[model samples]
Target chain A: MVSDNFFPQPGGVESHMYQLASKLIDRGHKVIIITHAYPGRTGVRYLTNGIKTYHVPFWTIYRETTFPTVFSFFPIFRNIVIRERIEIVHGHASLSNLCHEAILHARTMGMRTVFTDHSLFGFGEAGSILTNKLLKFTLSDVDHCICVSHTCKENCVLRASLDPSMVSVIPNAVVADNFRPLSQNEIDSRRSSAPGPPQPLGPNDTITIVVISRLFYNKGIDLLIAAIPRILASQPNVRFIVAGSGPKAIDFEQMVERNVLQDRVSLLGPVRHDEVRDVMVQGHIYLNPSLMEAFGTVIVEAASCGLYVVCTRVGGVPEVLPSHMTEFAAPEEDDLVAATNRAVAKLRSGKVRTDLFHNQVKQMYSWTDVAQRTERVYDSISTTRSFALIDRLKRYYGCGIWAGKLFCMCAVVDYLLFIFLEIFAPRERIDVCKDWPKKAVPVAKLGEEEDVESLKEGGVPGRKRNSRHRREKRDETDESSAA
Target chain B: MTTLITILTRLASPPPQTLHTHQPTSSTVTYTVTTRPALTGLCAKLGFYVGISARVVLGMVAVLVVCLKWCVSLGIGISVLGAFWGEGGERGMRRIMKLIEITDGTYIIPLAILVLFLACKRNYKEESLTIISGLGLQTSTTSSFYLRSPSTRFISTTAIQDIFIHEAFKGFEVRFYLAVVVEGEREVVVVFPSMLPRRGILEEVWREGRKCLWEMGEKG
Candidate 1:
């Protein structure tokens, strides 16, 4: 997997890459991550579950996105590809420079390339226009594309002009175990354990609403600021806990001060992903005022934490949860206020069975299910024949009148660079890395051994010794699996 | 103990720089043993001196131009200010010429020679790694000048925990290195850290170094 966004940077795409990689590893697939280096974190490092990350040092120009140097990354990327004997180069995030470059190079090198678009983009903006053209160039030769939701798929298809069948909708999932709701005993113990001024909510008590999004304009921080004052005014027994920080945070702070709602509103600035549930469980309602979202994974997380969700009806948000779990509102101040009030009323009446939400969400989305679906996508693409160079050029030519030719030129240059590298740094000169010892696959799960065999058939010639070692460990693995 | 093998190879960097893997005894190996500094040859020394002189001359000329430009500007400013006080411009021009003479007369040649000497102080000598049977490994980089001793580190045989060929990211590219994991040290001691030969060379050195360090003891 290749992306600019990966841990220890937190976001939807980062967690998506990590969870999917780990789950794929659990399914007995070799997975490694390629990301640009973060400060104090460079070189090769191993994460949980033996996922090796090559933090390739690159210049980051904006917001953790690596500066786009088109062919400069080819040598190192090619070295990594050869070292890992990688068959499929899975790239994530549309905006990631490393992903786009990897996709272009992977296609040039005759390796299967897969791209996952994590966010939605509009075609009207100038930035989106440029991004859309670039996306079209990369997706023109991509083996398959994955989007987090059907809305995202449609948006991506329209923006990139890709064939509908080539795109698959695989929703992002949360680790439900990490976002579990506090048990009744745990909540009672906490209330009795700490003698704080704030107490646990009883029937007809003050309703605590939670807002946990980064305070950016697109996240609807202004709408949140406007709705909070009115929501508190209309609902006398309501409190707000906003738990993120950004440029719009000062606006939120001023809203709290101007309304003199300091006692009721608490701002827990910039909570980590792991601590999200702890904040969620303290509230009766979860408010998401995002102006645009590809797939609102956090609302599902809030639902999993047993908080009744109040979200704006924006891109991919309505399709995430059922009507019973959330109260949807148009992205406006009054509607949000009304929605929060309605959710608060429901929580007061005890009509929503939030206690069962965790189980329902657990059944709704899972990384295992996502990995299985993604594996099917991989299997389908593996069976289909890849495009020839001429065919790839033709596809690039169809992107647009001017951009098409420019893209073809880029592909030609990238191909020439590949040829040059083949002569300059031959494959034999590069060392093949030792594979991480895989977890034992159970006998029942070995039904898809054909894929593994096919991958091994495409492995590097230098990997014979490692394969022999694996063969020797087969019996040990079987014993462990059997036990 | 007797001599086992000797493989003479070139460093991966460039030509004329060589690496020698010599096992004088059965359980000892010395690599990259250069008898003279890289700049010791007559032509190389002449070329080095010429390059340094040219750079120093260019630097001095650049300094002269900059200083002259500054003095001209300062002289003009002083003359303009002096004219307001009924002082003559000849005095300012004389002062600027004296300042120029002070800079150009005494300090330029000595400063240039000092800079040249300092530039020659860089280590243009080869680095070597030596391993003996019971005594551990010693890594050294020879200094170009005799005034400074070579920087060397010796890890005792017992303290030498492990040796392996590893690859890591350096700058924008991946490089192969032979690293020694010394006991109780957090960072591995990188053998041939500066030269950073290719994987083939590092693997050979790793195999030979390990055999000389530990495997021969086991066989005995």
Candidate 2:
């Protein structure tokens, strides 16, 4: 797998890649990641579930995406591909220059390529136009394109002018074990400590609505700022826990102060991705007023934690969960306020079975299921004969009247470059690296054990399995270097 | 910008007649001015031409005359607005420009470039990548790219290696522009300065160079 967004940088794409890679590794596939180096996380490293990641040192331009110097990545990328003996080079996130470069190089090396589009982009903005053209060029001959939702698929098709059949809608999955609701034992312990049966508040108990996302304009923080005061004024029992930090965070803080509702709104700042569930379970409702989203994985995570969701109807948020699991709102402030009001009423009436949400969400989305589907994509691509050089060029040629020809020329040159490289550095000279140790258990057993382990370790501050493993590995490597 | 605002609001806002109550005419019979469907279609076609006329005219000027690209782009933009949306063509051109601006910047410039690049496909001995490729290549300790022939030496970067692909693109024609690979004090700089039509070819060459990288990688 290749991407620019990865660990040390907390984001949707980063988490998606990590979770997917780990899940794929659990399914007995030797998954490795190739991403640009991040601060203090350079060179090769091992992540949880025995997933190896190579952080190639490159100059990051924006948002951790490296500057796209097309052919410059060839040498290092070629090294990594050869070392791992990668067959199918799956790339994630459309905005990643590393992903595009990897796909182009993988195809040149006669490897199958898959690209996953994680975000929705419109064709209007100058940035979008340039991105779409670049996307068109890269996706022109990609074996297949995976989109997080049907809406994303439609957007990708329109932007790249690709055939509908080539694009598949695979919704992102949340690890239900990590996002489980408060267990009965925990609730019992809490009741014993507080000496009251979890206060089914009569008429006026505070209902905490949680908003956990980067406070960015595209996230509809403006709409959230507009609606928060109104929602508070209308519903006396509601308070808020807004946990995230972004450029728009100050705006939210300002709104809370301006409305003098600072007491009602609690800003937790930026919480780690793993601690999101902890923040989520404290709330009665999850408020997502994002103006745009591709899959809205956080909503799924919220539902898994047993919070009633109130989100705007945009991008693929509508299709993520059932209408019963959520209250839909338009992007407008008035509509959001109205939606929040409805959710607050639903909570008061006890119409939503929040307790049953954890189990339902578990059944709906699982990393194992996602991994299985991805394996099928790999199976299909491997079984089918790879597109011939001429065939690939022809496909690229249909991109645009001029773009088609340009792409064709690119493909032809890439093919020639491949031939030249074959003569210079033969495949026989490269050494295949040994694979990481695989568990002896069956794939199904491994998956089930992973879920059980994750569940057992939930909310345990000192368990720190992932961090511990990373620390141990780093220490061992450090000692070895000293020797 | 004000005209843009008015036209946009006029199109989006409710029709003016909808606001007022209708009064019966004194005349016993009403006369209707009918427009033919074909005539309307013809007008729409004419409007489309007018809408795209700016792009077409600008493109012609760019291809026929060699000048600063941005000046041509700006000049043609102004001329198109004046010539196609003059007093006579205002109504139709307004609708076209409105649609263009809203949907996409008329896509005039990009579409024009695409056409020019495609049309200007010529056989050249050497294709060049531009200085922009210098962006990230400076950090790499050892970076190499392919050109047309395997023997074509790239200067300014440490020692370079070549793989001859005989009969590939009838002899591959790719050049890298300022692709720097730093090793200690010495650096390997691969420079390919792509001219107009050659720019497109250079991009193609860059895309094609991946194969060379892959092969040389396998040879390692």
Candidate 2, after superposition: displacement of residue A143 in Å? 0.9
Model 1 agreement with the true structure over B39-111: per-residue lDDT tens digits: 6679989987897677667666555545454545566644443454464567766675566545653465566
What TM-score against the true chain A does chain A of each candidate get?
Answer: 0.89, 0.89
lDDT by residue for model 2 over A5-85, one digit each (tens)? Answer: 887777778778877888888788999998887765565555556677777888999777899888777766776677578
Q: Which stretches of candidate 2 lie over 4 Å from their true place?
A: A188-201, A440-483, B1-220
Model 1 Cα lDDT, one tens digit per residue, A382-429 = 888878899999999998899999999999999999876766566765
**Cα-based TM-score, every candidate:** 0.75, 0.63
TM-score of chain A of 2: 0.89
Number of the predicted model whose DockQ against the real structure is largest: 1
lDDT of 1: 0.80
In model 2, state the lDDT of residue A439. Answer: 40
C-alpha lDDT (0 to 100) for residue A101 of candidate 1: 98
- Please list the C-alpha lDDT of all candidates, in the order they appear: 0.80, 0.69
